[model samples]
Target: MAITREEVLHVARLARLSMSPAEADKMREQLDNILAYIRQLDRLDTADVVPTSHAVEMGTPFRDDSVHPFEEKEEILKNAPDREGDFFRVPRIIED
Candidate 1:
């Protein structure tokens, strides 16, 4: 399939692009080549092939989720510049 200069101009207009006549001619040739390649691919027989999202088969490698207790709350709070009770305090951002 060949892409015409008119089609290229129409596409460029849709994309709001401004190109010179030379650029348009170049784009037409490039688009035509791309379309020709795609048309060539249409001739391939893949009726029995199953569709896959990835080129290679892979499985999710996940470890068992385990809960661990953090016993250093006081140690972590000791480094806070502004501590309020058991938590770090910050400037109030919301206004009533």
Candidate 2:
């Protein structure tokens, strides 16, 4: 499909662009070339192409799910700058 001068002017106005008379002609030609390329692409045969969700096959690796408690809490808390009893204490965060 070929884009018209009126179409370019209307689109430019909608996009809030201050296009001069020379710019409108240049934009019309550029848009027409892009549309012509799309028209050419549309003529390609893609009937045998299979639709795929992913470019490559995907799967999660097998792993046994397990839960465990910390063996030495005091040893880990020794590196903290601030601590309150059995837990680490930090400054409060206020989002504006």
Candidate 3:
């Protein structure tokens, strides 16, 4: 597929890019080459090949989730500038 100057200009407009005539010509050539490479891939015979998301097999390496209570609540609250009972007091942002 040969990309034209008009197609390049349209793409540039959609992308909100300002290109000179020389830049558009250069982009047209580059885009045409990329399309030609993809056209070459269309000629491949992969009827028996299975579709895969990744080139290599992979698995999630995540650990099991576990919960625990804080050992020292008073120690943690000591760092807060403003506190009320067991929680830190923050300034009210929204008027009800």
Candidate 4:
């Protein structure tokens, strides 16, 4: 399947691109080569081949999730500029 210069220009227009004649020519050649390669791949025999989601198989690398209670609440609260009892205090942001 050969790509035409007009097709390349149309795609460029759809993408909101302003291409010079030289750039359009280059893009058309590149698209033509890509389509030619796809045509070649279409001729390959895949009757016995099994389809796969990825080229390589992989295992999940994530660790099991667990929760633990924090032990240093008073130590962390020492860095707060303003505190109200057990929580950090900030200027009121909501209006009634």
Candidate 5:
């Protein structure tokens, strides 16, 4: 699972990266270590274990996205640096 410098350079080229020889060497070592760790994980016996989606037993922790009307439109508009009739006035981006 050792990643070579040539392979690293090929990957960098495909990703449109301009890498030095030193960077390629560093990445090669890092990627080799990662692959070695994955190999260690592959050696573990998982014959009786069920694959889990979450590491912890969990609940749905998200809040509901409920739409609410503006209570005080004037309050929000007061803080704007540039405001129109009822909305924030931004610079005209589109050409006529």
Candidate 6:
């Protein structure tokens, strides 16, 4: 499919972009090339092909959740500039 210069200008206006005549011409060419590539891809035979979210096979990247209790409570709390018992004290932001 060939992209028109007017269509490119219309898209630019919709996107709130200020395009010069030269820039619009360039954009029109690039969009035309992309559409041509898509048209080329449409000629492929994919009757036996499976639709997938990714191009390659993917496995779950996440590990099984395992709870591990933290041991150094006092040692960690020692770094706090201000603490109220086991919690860090911060200035009250909301008046309730």
Q: Residues 1-96, candidate 1, lDDT per residue (tens digit)?
A: 487899999999999999999999999999999899888867879798788788888897797899887998899999988988998998889987
Candidate 3 regions exceeding 4 Å error are 46-57, 60-96
Which lDDT tens digits does candidate 3 get at residues 1-96?
478899999999999999999999999999999999888867888898888788878886886698687899899999999999998998889978
All candidates: TM-score:
0.46, 0.45, 0.47, 0.45, 0.47, 0.45
RMSD of each: 12.3, 13.0, 10.8, 11.9, 8.1, 10.6
Candidate 4 least-lDDT 10 residues:
60-69
Tens digits of per-residue lDDT for model 5, 3-94 = 78899999899999988889888899999999888888778898898998898978879978998888998999999999879989988898
Off by over 4 Å in 6: 45-96
The deviation in Å at residue 77 for candidate 4 is 33
Which lDDT tens digits does candidate 4 get at residues 1-96?
A: 498999999999999999999999999999999899888867889888888788888996786688787999999898999999999998889887
Residue 60: error of model 6 in Å?
A: 14
After superposition, the stretches of candidate 2 with alpha carbons farther than 4 Å from their true spots are 45-96
lDDT of each: 0.90, 0.88, 0.90, 0.90, 0.88, 0.89
Q: Write the per-residue lDDT of candidate 6 for residues 3-94, one digit (tens) a residue.
A: 89999999899999998999999999999999998888678898888887887787879967998889999998999899999999888899
Give the least accurate 10-residue stretch of model 5, judged by summed lDDT. 35-44
Better of 3 and 5 by lDDT: 3
